[model samples]
Target: MERLCFGIDIGGTSVKLGLFTENGNLLDKWEIPTRREDSGSHILEDVAATVKKKIADDNLVRENIIGIGIGVPGPVTEDGTVINCVNLGWGIFNVSEETEKLTGFKTRVGNDANVAALGEMWQGGGRGYKNLIMVTLGTGVGGGVILNGEILTGSNGAAGEIGHITVNPSEEDKCNCGRPGCLEQFASATGIVKEAKRLLDKSKEPSKLREIQHLSAKAIFDCAKEGDALANELVEELCRYLALALSHIAHVVDPEAFVIGGGVSKAGTMLTDLTKKFYENNVLFALKNKDFKLAELGNDAGIYGSAKLIIGK
Candidate 1:
């Protein structure tokens, strides 16, 4: 029988699972609800049972299966101990050990964002580049750093938490991370809307943005594309913050490229163009003109990255 492995990405709402060949071809993919209640106690068991059922349904021999790779939304130690996963109501524990016990398969776990970057590096936008940073701009900003084809998981397993990087020091409002002026506070989808509303409330500038009752980040980008002055200004500001964050990161990692993903990235070339323009303006001279590609894997990036934990590494 062909060799196989499991890739699981555990989110607050659902768990995405993929079965893949040892080399990286996804054979099957599915999702199971994350039983986050009761401290998410049922999550691993449910996932294990699902995998076992899948294997039995296919009549695959257990000996041919490689192992399991998992991605969670928190810092994970080198040995698979999850330091804390507030979103999943999980405390410090050896997740890989627990998963291995439940599923009877060797296990590895990494932070979801970091694994996503690895996925991009292996088969998505970061393909052909061994070193890169993944910038995920969603409800909040998330990032992953990959160096020489491996994850740079830092001393505390928090090397890629780029969202919390401070961008301003004087802002009164605090980010969810309890810090003021974090990069996510100014660059994420929520941040873009907050900035849009702030601009609308603070300025009397006549633009189409005032016509919409419920503004969204997409709407802002759409209006900017349509040449609305205030909306364009907002997009410019958003890209400025995003590119500024990448510039700071580039000085440290100096990766081959930066892959931008998440819901906000749907803005497409407009977002990347402005971000690249600004990023090139401020980044180190040696790092100027680095490649900036849009993330190609979409939501599947985590699963692919999780699989890479088993397949490539």
Candidate 2:
């Protein structure tokens, strides 16, 4: 039988599972809606059973399945315990132990953002780059860092938190982590909408964005493309903040490249071009040579990263 491995990514609304060959070829992939009850035990059970059923259906032997790797949304302890996951309603979980016991396979776990970074390093935009950073901008901003071709989980397994970095220390905007003025507070999709609303409320500029009662970052981008001056200005400001955060990251990590991922990245080259311009303008002279690229794998980075973890140290 061919050697294969299981990679699972647990999200608040859904779970993505993939079967992969030893070399990182995605053999099969599937998803299940996440059922958020009180704990993550049932979720683990669901994942184990799903993988076992798939193995049996494919006539694959247990030994041929090398291991399992999981990516959770919240902070994970060094030894694989989930400390807290507000999105999943999980607290102090032994995810690795649970999955191993349920599936009879060696299992490892890491934070979703970290795993996604590993994924990018393995086969996405960061592929071929020894050191890289992945910045994911969505409902909230999230990031992962890879150094020397390995994911850096820090001493507490909670490093690479680029989103929580303070942009304007004096500006107070609440972050999901309960902090104020985090980069996510102004650079994420939600952040863009928040900024757009602030602009509209202030009536600072005439904008077609007013037509959409429930404005989203994507809508703002659309409006900008249609020559909405306010939308364009908002996009510029958002990109400026993103560049500020990235400039800080550049000075510290000094990674070879910075990869921007998530839903907002789908804004395509428009976001990238503006981000590049701002990053160059903001970063210190010593760090001006770094490349900024968009994440190529899009949504699949997590699963790919999980698979990379299972492939071993």
Candidate 3:
């Protein structure tokens, strides 16, 4: 019988699950609402029940299953102990152990961002590259680092926290992490809007961005493409800070490529092109040639990487 595996990506709003063949073909996928009540105690139960139902509905033999792999929204140790998941109302706990007990199958777990990186490396933009860095720029910045074909979890499982890197120590505004001058403060979608507003507040330059009351990063990029000087300046500043952050990372990990993902990545080549130009200009000569590509898997990267964790692909 052909073996199958389960990949689960648990997020704040819902849990994304995928059934995949041993060879990494996605056979089925679905989602369930995350019940955050009671410290998220019902989450694993719900997942296990869904898996059992899926197995029965598909008439699949449980013995042919490899194992379950999960991606959590927080730092997870090598042993599957999640240190804390604020969105899930979870504190430090052995996720694999509990999940195995609930589902009667061996399980492996990883941080969601790291798992997404693995997915990209296995089947997405980072395919063919063993060492890569994935930067997710959404409301905030998130990152994952892969080195020598493995996720760099570090001692505390916080190795890929590129957002918290201090880029402007003099800035008085605090990041969501309660610190000032983080890369997230200037490189994320929210950061772009913030920077645009700041620049507009201080400068007399007129542009289309001044007309939009509900400004977004996409609007700024669009205006930049349409020849808005202020918007172009915002993009330049965004790319400069992002490139500076990546340059620092390049010197440390020296990854072969940087995969840019998240909502902001929808700006497409406009974003990557500018960021790449600045990155090449700022990084060491040896690292200037590193590739910068947008993420290909979209929201499914987490599940793909989660499956790879158990299947060893």
Candidate 4:
């Protein structure tokens, strides 16, 4: 029976590979450095070579493997065409077709953030919920919306870009996406630190952040836990931005839950609690009772979600 699948997550530094059963169980996992020396022209070739080598090493039957699924850091249409992947130095192309030709199996592909959300929905934080949103608060904010157990890859596969939502139109700075006052400018780990630094630069506030040589999201949150007034204010600001974004999303999809992930989510319940507290106040009463859960799979979410593409769980 075709009960196995391959999952690949292509990152700027490395590629995560996993073998999974149809039931969403991870059988084995590994990683390989991404050779981006040639504009990533060799990435798919390398991934195919690695998958074939693994099958040979394990004496696995090709018939038993359902297919392969991959997640890339860019927009991907339903037919598996990647519009652009700057991190990997890739241009527009049909990723699935190329991957299938190389691996001799059916292939599927999706945006990395979107696929990560699918992973959480399948076997991690959003498990048992058919509808939910996955929010990644790392270097930049990213999101994946799952509605009725399927990823909502809107027109042109750019559906769940919640980070780019405009929050502060009056701000002068431009976001990485070339927009002003995006939600990511306030909610992401880097955004939080940047805001903290900006505050320390202009204001003579007696903040512990001013003393730290290298301010990070962790430091800010830790200081908040220790009763630092300035840190608390920053944390509240970050949560407020997140709450506003969540409120907007809730009004649209009304997901059953919101799964928080990425490096900044390390703050744990404090982050979720604060965001939820603000979220409830702004959103309609019907949307206030949604679950706010921490992501359970961590970095493994990508590979798991990739496998889900093949097993369809």
lDDT of 1 by residue, 1-313 (tens): 6799999999999999999988789899999999999897888999999999999998888999989999999998889999889989998899999999998999999999999999999989999999999999999999999999999898878989989988777878999988899989988999989999899899998999999999998999999999999999999988998888899999988999999999999999999989999999987789998888999989999999998887665
Error of 1 at 78 (Å): 0.8
The models' CA-based lDDT, in order, is 0.92, 0.87, 0.93, 0.93
* TM-score of candidate 4 against the unseen true structure: 0.97
State the lDDT of candidate 4 residue by residue for 1-313, as single tens digits.
Answer: 5489999999999999999988988989999989887889999999999999999999999999999999999999998999889999998999999999998999999999999999999999999999999999999999999998888888898999989988888988999999899999999999999999888788877878878999999999999999998899999999998989989999999999999999999999999999999999998878888899999999999999998977774
Least accurate 10 contiguous residues by lDDT in model 4? 199-208
What is the lDDT, from 0 to 100, of the residue 228 in candidate 3?
98
Winner by TM-score between candidate 4 and candidate 2: 4
RMSD of each: 1.0, 1.7, 1.0, 1.2
Model 3 per-residue lDDT tens digits across residues 232-268: 9999988899999999999998999999999999999
Local error of candidate 1 at 171, Å?
Answer: 1.9
lDDT of 1 at 192: 89
Find the 10 residues in a row with the least total lDDT in model 1: 304-313
Q: For model 3, what is the error of residue 145's alpha carbon versus the real structure, in angstroms, after optimal superposition?
A: 0.4
Q: Compute the lDDT of residue 44 as modeled in candidate 3.
A: 91
